[model samples]
Target: MVVLSRRIRSEDWKPVGVSELEVNALQVVRSVDNRSVIAGPGAGKTELLAQRAAYLLQTGASPAPRRILAISFKRDAATNLAARVRQRCHRIHAERFDSMTFDAFAKGLIDRFGQALPERWRPRSDYEIMFPGDRDYREFLSRQIGVPPAHIGTYADIQAISVKTFERRHLVGTPLPLDGWLQPTPAQWAAGCYWQRFLHEGKKSFLSFSMIGRLAELLLRVNPMVQDALRLTYSHLFMDEFQDTTPIQYELVRTIFLGANTVTTAVGDNKQQIMRWAMAMDDPFSAFDGDFGATRTPLYNNYRSSPELVRIQHILAQALDVQAVAPVSKTVGTIAGASCAIWDFSTPGVEAAHLAAFVAAEIKAQALSPRDFVLLVRQKASEYATVLEPAFVAAGIPMRNEAGMVGAIMLQDLLVEAVSKLIVNVLRLAMATRAGRHWTTCQEALTALVGIAHDDEIAQAKFANELDAYVVTLKATYPNSPKSKVASRAIVEDILRFVGREKVVAAHPAYGQGGWLDEVLDSVAGHLLASSCNHTEWSSALDVYEGIHAVPLMTIHKSKGLEYHSVIFVGLDDGAWWSFANDQIEATAGFFVAFTRAKQRVVFTYCSHRGARTNIATLYQLLTNAGVKKVKIA
Candidate 1:
């Protein structure tokens, strides 16, 4: 075994505070063997993972030019880890490290081995990977499964079943058993039938995201050269959020480098494995057991939360049947008036109003920014929109919800019309420039660019006459060449000025700072400069920029791997959280995950009645038993 302290300088590799548990985990990372790190919440697992990558690069454990592959369950996680590694390691060696999500890794393998795939799996010339859309495909499945379109549940379910079948390594012609995770419902049976046809149609049709993983597994198994190349390319593999990994994902990793020279590290909290319904395995530790001989390392330190928060997490972990290791916290003193509280309301609407007011009061009292707070719910739906948005508006609080951003960008008619017209005019300008048309006046183009109707001759002539003089001045100041950077800048500035950028920003403060409009303009100008302006590209750019900060509101599932200074977990009634399962394990795990998201304080809200039933007895008992204090809202 190699000791990292001896191999590397103290200044180069720090974070050593004489803790036995952290020492064990760090040793495991520096070792040249397989290891499984069972890191509980707030254990600094991400920092540990980032350090491991740095160690491998700095200590020459992984030679230069040979990469270390770090896989994360989420894109943000991967990106953050890569950034951390770059900051810690030397630039020359840090460039050898690569990080990506599992789906992205699978897609890369598929692209490399597309020609070597079996005929049935081989894609046609125009075949593209389609997402879980395409109503025609779902209708085709409905006909085959002897069900109507409405009864097909969702394309998501079909994709899940298909991925699960491949994970189990079931043969092509085998009937997907109705036992285990798959129930014998009409929808399940339909999914099973659709899974088979989904494979058959892979040649000419689009492949779902799940199919990418299955294909990568197949390609690796059938092509030994690709397997060897991959094994040699990466010297170390570090996977974050290992507990959330599906079985197929584990198998894919195992097939590529299990018996090879590559050392692997899997880090996650088994207690937070709440994604079992999405095909995450019940026992993630089994991935490291037998054949691999992985060393187990546990990290129990709670560095992010107060001592009070750590105590609550310990109690909840015990209730959920997860192995409870009391978190060691250095923050001995709790914040004044920061104790956990459960708020009960007479009505959902009233609850929303109270929540908005409470958040405003907390922000002022703590002198915290709006970004420091997060509102988490079990589900985001019409109820959230109706109750929360108006209440926040009435309270003069800024709030942003992920669903709202997506809807505003994708559904708003005015924004959509403006973006579409911009794309069209950009494309037309590119074509005219390519054809060497020198006499095209900017005034006539701007008239069409604004989407003015050709039949409205009076309005067109009026605008064209006003802008004709301006065009002469613009031509003198800026070159007429399409590819010139100066020309692109002038066009973007003039269009933004004409489109009332100031008015747009002033009207929609929810879009965040002034930079958002600039981002939109830059995206449009980049596309126009490249002569690649299309509706899809332009809409995607708008969607990306529309995600600027307001105040993050998301479901608990989406809130995983995220933390805030103050957290409000709303809609904690029976139907929303516990209704997802008959057994209490999943619900308990979910609540545990939600509770640990708070760094300083947590507020759990529940209504007296949700749609018809009173508050759930089980939930009330769990909270009271866990020692949560009941608080009255003014």
Candidate 2:
């Protein structure tokens, strides 16, 4: 018997759920040497990191009393990684694993060590965070740079979204342009003034996520004691999605963990580096290796797609990364039809109607859940919704645009998902004659949502009882038979009152519980009003929807790190991917990511009359070579 750790034997271990890529990578999981792992989509990067944490914690490899910090780029990714570690190890061991976004990690440092920063850079305790756009910077500059109100044009009227960053030199207090204070140009002057005013927001500093990263870096460099404390607290570190790491974020890691005798692992695929517009590093692997003296490893197995689909991926992968080899598929080809196909239409409305009718008819014939299919668009899911919504509505299929905004919150916000899913399932479970399997899953989700460890018997028991008591209250309050239909919007309000909106707000500080959360709650409840379904039909729209009965329509970027039974790509013409010619590699990479998000079959829909087909010429050639069938509907 091969012993992985103290209590984990070979047969007892599995990577992620339903992903049995085996424990073959156990050596890397248990390795002490710092490494940068590059793997394609569905290669099980999350599983590898989770298993590594499990191995280190279970075996005391991290030298006990010390913890492991894993930083991810997204909230869901971080929470999912933490949940996996909890599921794989004992409660005591699992509690040592800490996973959070890079922003959250940096924000925490500022919250704790702002007083240690130089007086000029220290933020007030009540500083508010804002996500500013480029327009905000331009508008702020228009006012401070002596641009006349008449000449300021549209910028004069622009409302600032945040305190924006200016040119690198001016923001750091360097006005080395051809001119002085206002600099060579008004823009440079605005940049310098913006930096000066960043800390002077009426006695309350305004900080952005990037600003937080910069401050965190400054704090560590000036105060080595803080670094020493962090090193003492966490002996091992993992950076997930390293390819998307920016220069300052990388520097933040280098200052604290480099040569501090900490084992650091960075895992990501350079090909999937999609945040270039936000200034993702040009070469993260090389940069990380240069700093950490780390070795490189790549996992070349595709566990999420069928063999035919893998071949289609190879067609696009070669165009994106010539040096990288294609991943062999672990999924067998079982779909009776062609693994890939394309549908051509003369107009967007025709295409949308055909797609909705096709999917709805297929569900009726095949007896499959609507959730089995996912719709992917290049960007702005709402643009496609105008045509898609009515078509789907006529077809009687429940589909929600996952990328749309609700007031100030994106529909995918963690707090929104937690609250929305909780209410939907709670209502369903309440009216049922018997408790279903969903209740157990829902309970676990509630536990994780409130930051409870999976193995904490006392806390779990207490929460479970509280949940039962809450349900009892709900039963008495809304007592009805199973057939009694309820309003989805009302359910949202009910959960808010039952849990006390304040408590929900206090639980997730990431999104806040104040006016912002209230706006989100109100907008979410209003959004549900878009659905005409009384109750049963509305369940699909409001549920967390991990399983059957809901079709998730989102952008290709949001669809990463996920898979579905089938995939539908809408708007595959030049207009949707307008910048394809400028950055063909990244464009191809986006298309690659989209196609790889399928388990059995994938479909693409393009409207010839909608836009020019020249941009996606390579994709067309690749699909044809992979034997993907094409059909036109006029």
* lDDT top scorer: 2
lDDT of 1 by residue, 1-634 (tens): 1223234653466533233336666686577888888887888787787677767776778876689999977665676677676556654565677888887787777765756876656544334555553454444543444532455455455444343333233322222232312443434455445555655564554555466676777778878899999888999999888888876677788888878988888898888887776667778777575557788878878777788888888887887654577878755544687568888788888888888887788778878777778888887544576678788868877566643432223211222333434434433333332423422433333554465654688997777665545544544544333455455556767655654554434333312232434555554455444432221243233322232233567777767787888888887776675464454677677888888888888898877667422445565566677688887654
State the lDDT of candidate 2 residue by residue for 176-274, as single tens digits. Answer: 222224323334445545644776658677877777787788889888999999999998999998888877788888889988888999998888877
Question: Candidate 1: worst 10 consecutive residues by lDDT?
Answer: 406-415
lDDT, model 2: 0.72
Q: Report the lDDT of model 1 for residue 316.
A: 79
Cα error, residue 363 of model 2, in Å, equals: 3.2
Q: How does residue 424 of candidate 1 score in lDDT?
A: 41
TM-score of each: 0.70, 0.84
- C-alpha displacement of 525 in model 2, angstroms? 4.3
Clashes within 3 Å, all models in order: 0, 0
